[model samples]
Target chain A: MFDINKRPEVIQLSHGGGGKEMNKLIKSLFFSAFNNPILNNDEDAARLHLNGDIAFTTDSFTVSPLFFAGGDIGKLAIAGTVNDLAMMGAKPEYLSCSFIIEEGFEVGKLKKVVDSMVNEMDKSGAKIVCGDTKVVPKGCADGLLINTSGIGRIQFDGVSVTNIKLGDVIIVSRDIGRHGAAILMERESLALETTLTSDCATLWPTVKHLIEAKLEIHAMRDATRGGVSAVLNEWAMGSNVGITVKESAIPVCDEVKGMCELYGFEPFDLANEGTFLIALPEDEAIKALDIMHEFGCEATAAIIGRVSEDRPGKVILKTPWGSRRYLDLPQGELLPRIC
Target chain B: MFDINKRPEVIQLSHGGGGKEMNKLIKSLFFSAFNNPILNNDEDAARLHLNGDIAFTTDSFTVSPLFFAGGDIGKLAIAGTVNDLAMMGAKPEYLSCSFIIEEGFEVGKLKKVVDSMVNEMDKSGAKIVCGDTKVVPKGCADGLLINTSGIGRIQFDGVSVTNIKLGDVIIVSRDIGRHGAAILMERESLALETTLTSDCATLWPTVKHLIEAKLEIHAMRDATRGGVSAVLNEWAMGSNVGITVKESAIPVCDEVKGMCELYGFEPFDLANEGTFLIALPEDEAIKALDIMHEFGCEATAAIIGRVSEDRPGKVILKTPWGSRRYLDLPQGELLPRIC
Candidate 1:
C-alpha cells in the first residue's frame, strides 16, 4: 500500500545528502528505471572492461527553468551524454555526474531532477559511478547545472567518419526538433496548443542494433544543438563530400512543425535530443532502416539523402516543390540551452 | 617592445581560443610566473610516465564574481583540484580542463582568468592534457564555469584517513581561513582595513617532500568548503576517536583574525582554499613540519591538537582559560562556492 506512483514531484537537498531519502529516491526511481547489472550493483564506481577500444564523451547541462514541459534538466543531462557516446558506436557503460547548485534553490526540486536523471540513466542501462557536488550562494548561479561525462567501449572496429563514401545513404532516426520546440513553448507566453512531447530517449539500443546488423555504417552524428542541418554540414565538411536530401523525405511531426511555424523557426535548423543522422552504403540502407524500426523508433526513419561526388563539402536540399536549395551551416546557436 | 608587466588585468575569451593573444598571454604571464619543464612543452595534452601508484582529483569553478578580492575563479579551480590530489599523498601530474561559457561575456576578462589558471598549473607542475568548450546562451548562466579534473600518482603507502590513530598529533599547513575572509570581505563590503590575500596555492610539492622523507603521515585533508572545524569533526567521527586542540597554538594572520572578529565569524569555522591538516605520529611531527617548510610553504607550521580515545566521535578546543568546549561539525555551508 505504498502508493509509490504518488511520490512528490519536487526535489530536496536531503536527496543529495546520502541519507535515507537519497536511498529511497535511488531505489524507487533510478534503479527501477535503469535496471542493469552494473547499476544494480550499487557501487561507488563501476568496474569496466578495459580491453576494447574506448570512446569518451562529456557534456554539461545548464538548461534554464531546470524542469521544462515534457522533461527536466536531469533527464536531458543523462540522455545527452549517452547519445554522445552512442554516436561513436560505443556501448556506454559508466558515467560521472557533477552538480553545481545554487543556495536557496529548493532542495526538493533538486531531488526531483536527480530522480529524473536516475530514471533516464537506468533506462539507458548506463551506470552512474562517482559524483561531486558544490553549492554556491543564492543569486550567484542559475538554479542548477549538471555536468556528465561518459566512457563506453567502442565495439565496432572500423567505424570512423573517414569511412563515408560518395554514394552512402543518409537515414534519420526520428522526427526533428521536438525537444527544442517543447522548451521554447514552455519559456514563452505563446498560447499554442499541441501534443509536442520532447524526443528525449536513449538511442543506445538502436545504435547497438545498427552495429550488430553488420550494416556498412559510414558515419553517425546526433542532432543536438544547432540540429540536423548543423550535424549534416559538419559531416559533409569533415568527410570532404557533398550531400543532397529530399526535403519531403525528412520526417517532422505535425505538432512540432506547427509550433515551429508559429514561432518563425525552421525545423531543419532546430535542436533534436534523440535523433541521429546515419550514413551507410546504399546496399545496406533498407536493412538498417528495418533494424532501427524494430527498436520502436519507426515513424520517422527514412532515407532522406545521399552523399554526392559532384560537389564537395556542400549540402543541398531538393524541396517539395521541385526546386533545389543549398542548406547552409547554422551561423549561431538557434535555441540556446536546448539540450 | 611590449610592456608585459603593465598589461591589463581583466581576462578575455581570446586567451582560451588558441590564438595570438593566447600565446602572448601564456608566455608573458604564465611562463614567467611558474617556470617548469612539463608545462613549458605546450602540447595539447601532457604525456607522462605512471611509475608507482596514482591518485586523481577534479574540481569546478563557478564563483559569482570571476575576480574576487584576493583571487579569481581560475586560480581557485587549479589550486582546489591540485590540493585534492596532494591530500592523498599523490604527486600531481596531468590535468584536463573543460569550460562552460556563457555567450556575450566580455572576451578580455576571460583571458586574464585563463592566464591565471595556466600560471597556477605551471606552478603546480601539472600539465594540461585534454580540454573541452561549450557555449550557453547569455543569461542562461553566469559568465563562465571551469571544470578541471586531474590524475596524480600516490608516492607513498599507508597514507589515508583509515590509518589515523588515537594518540596522533595534528599539524596544520598554515593560517586557517584567510581565503574565506577575503571572499566574504569582497561580498559583504566589511569596512575592515586589512591587506589579506587568499592562501590558495599548489600543495603537491610540499606533500611530496613529506612522503619522500618517510615521515609517518597517518592522515591528511584539505580544509576547503566546510572549513577546518568541519574537516576535523568529520575525521574524528570517521575514525571513531576524539580530538583536542589548543586555540593558542593555531596560526591566524593578524589581518584575517581582525576581519573575522569584525564580521562575528570564527576563523576555525571559515574555509581555507590552500591550507591542509595532517595527522602524524607524535615522534615524526618535527620532521614532517621541516619537510613542508623546505618546500616554500608557510614555515610557521604548528602542532595544534592530538587525537584521543576518550569521548569518541567528538572534538574539543582548549581555550586560553583552560576550559574545553565542544567543536561541533558545521551543520550547513559557511562560505558556499569558496573554491
Candidate 2:
C-alpha cells in the first residue's frame, strides 16, 4: 500500500530526524534497496560473523556534479573502498556506507544513486550491512557526500609496498586518467563527440581472478587522487628502490591526453578510479595480464615500468628521446573534489 | 626533523590532493595523534585479526558550531559510533574515520579536533586503524563533517529491541536534553548563567561494566535524536508491547527545562548523546542501576517506565495529576544535525 505520490519529492530535515519520518524513509527506500538479514534487524548496530585476518579501509567521495558519464558518487563510493580492500588481496565482503546529504535534494536522484550503489556492489559480491544518513540544511552542503568503509577477510597474504624488490615488473590495469577527464568534461560542460566516460569500476573481480590464479602480487594500489605518479613515487620511497618508466609505454587515452593538453596538466598525475598498478616478478607479468584481461573491465592492461636497484628512492622517467629525469610526487592542487 | 612552524597554518586543497603535501599532513598530524602499528603499515587497507560475532555501525556527525559546551564534533563522532556498539553489549575495538573538510579551515583547529578524538578513543580502548581525508572547496561544505564506522566484538548476546517483554522495567541513564540544549544555546549565543553542558561521553565503560556484571539486559539504546520518546515508541512497536511512562519520574536538568520552556519543546523529544535507556526484567533493575551508577558518566539513572501488554505498539504517558495521554513518535523536524 505504499504510494509514490504520498512520498515527498525532495528530502527534508525531518527525514534525518530519528523519528517516524526517518523510519518511514529508511524502511521504504533504504531497506528495500539494501535489504538483508543483518540490516533488517532493527538494532543500533549490525551483527556480523568475522574470523581470521581481515582488511579494513575507508574512503569519502566528494566528487562534484554528483553524476558523470560512467558513474555517480554512489558508484565511486562503493568502488573506491572496495578497491582498497581488493588491493590488499582481501575478499570484499561487508561494507558500511554513510551519507551526508543536503536538504531539498531530489528524492528521485537519491534513489538513482542508491540503485547505482546496488549495481556496483553486485560486481564484488559485497553487502552494505550497516549505514547512516544525515541531511544537512540546504546551503550548508553542496549536495551529497558519501563515506564508505569496508571490511573484508584477507584471502591472500604478504602484499605490501615494502615487498617490492628489484627486477619486479610494474603493470597498469588500463588506460589512465579517464575518471579525471570525465569529471573535468562534465564540469566544463564540454560537448565533444567522443564517447568518453569515467573509468569508475569495481576491481574486485579482477583481483579475485588473480588470487584464484595464484599470481604472486608483491604490491597493488589504485592510482587515485594523485594518480600514477603519486603511487610510483610512494612505491619508490617505501621500498627504498628506484623505478624506471618509459613515458611512451604508459597508456593514455586520446580524450584524457586532449583534456590534459587543454588544461596544462599531466595525464600521469590525473586521477583514475578504476586503474590500478601491480608489481610482481617479471616472469609472472604475462600470466597476470592474461587473467586481468579476461576479467577486468577494460582489456588495455600494459607493463609500464619496472623496479630497479639504481638510484634508490626515486622514480626515473625515460622519455621517447632517451632522456631520463626524476618523476616527483604531484605537488599543489590539481583538481579538487575529483574523487 | 618535523618542524611545526614550517607547516601551513590553514588546511589547503593541496593537503588533501593525495600528494606530497597530503602525505606530510597525514604523517605529521593524523599519524602522530593516532599512532599504531597497523596504521603505520601504510597499506591501502589495515589488516586486522578478528574472531567470533562482532557488531558493526556507522555514523556521520554534522553538528553545527563544531565546538559546543562539554564536547566537540570530534568527541561526538567517536562516542556516537562507539555507543552504538556498546548499546549492543559489544567491546569497541576498531574504528575507521573519514573526514570531509572545507578548504581554508584552520590547521590548528583540525589538530585540536584530532587530539580530542584521541582522548575519546582512550576511554574505550578503541583504535582507528584506517581512515580517509577529503577536502572540498570553500562554500561547498560548512567547515567539517566526520564519518566514523566502528567494529566491536559482541560480549553479551540477545540484547535487541525485539527482546523486550511484559514486566520489563525501563531505566533512563541520566538527565536528558543537555546535548540538544547546549547546542541550541551555542547556536543562539545564549549568555545564561546556567552551567548546562552536553551529556556527550563514551558509554563503553558503563556498558562493559554491565556486561561483566552479568545483567540479563533485554534492550539498550542511547537516546539520541528524538530522545527517549523515539526509543520507547520504536521498542513498543518492535516488541509488540505497550510502554507506560511516568512523566514525573524522568530526570531533566533545570537548565534544559528552562530551554524547553523557552523554545516550546518537549524534554522527552530533545536529543542526548550520552544518555541511554534500558529495558530489563524488574528483578534486575536494582543490580543494573548499581553497576551503571558506578561506571556511567552520570549518576542520575532512574526507572522511568515499564512494559505492558495493554496497548501494543503504543506508548502511554502518565502525568503527575492522574492524566494520561498517548506519546507518539516525534513528527516533523525536532532538530536537525543534533548528533
Worst 10 residues of 2 chain A by lDDT: A292-301
lDDT string for model 1 (A275-297, tens) is 88889889998898888899858
Residue B266 of model 2, lDDT score: 92
Model 2 lDDT tens row, A1-339: 877678569999999988889889888988899888988996999999988999999998899999999999999999999999999999999999888889999999999999999999999999999888898999888999989999999999978988899999999999999999999999999998889999999999999999999888899999999999999998999999999999999989898989999999999999999999999999999999999889864677999999999899999999999999999999999899998
TM-scores of all predicted structures: 0.82, 0.97
Q: State the lDDT of candidate 2 residue by residue for B76-123, as single tens digits.
A: 999999999999899999999888999999999999899999999999
Candidate 1, which segments miss by more than 4 Å at Cα? A1-53, A157-163, A189-191, A213-216, B1-58, B89-103, B124-140, B150-159, B189-193, B211-216
- Per-model C-alpha RMSD: 6.5, 2.9
| Candidate 2 CAPRI category | high
Candidate 2 TM-score, C-alpha based: 0.97
The local lDDT score (0 to 100) that residue B186 gets in candidate 2 is: 93
Total backbone collisions, model 2: 0
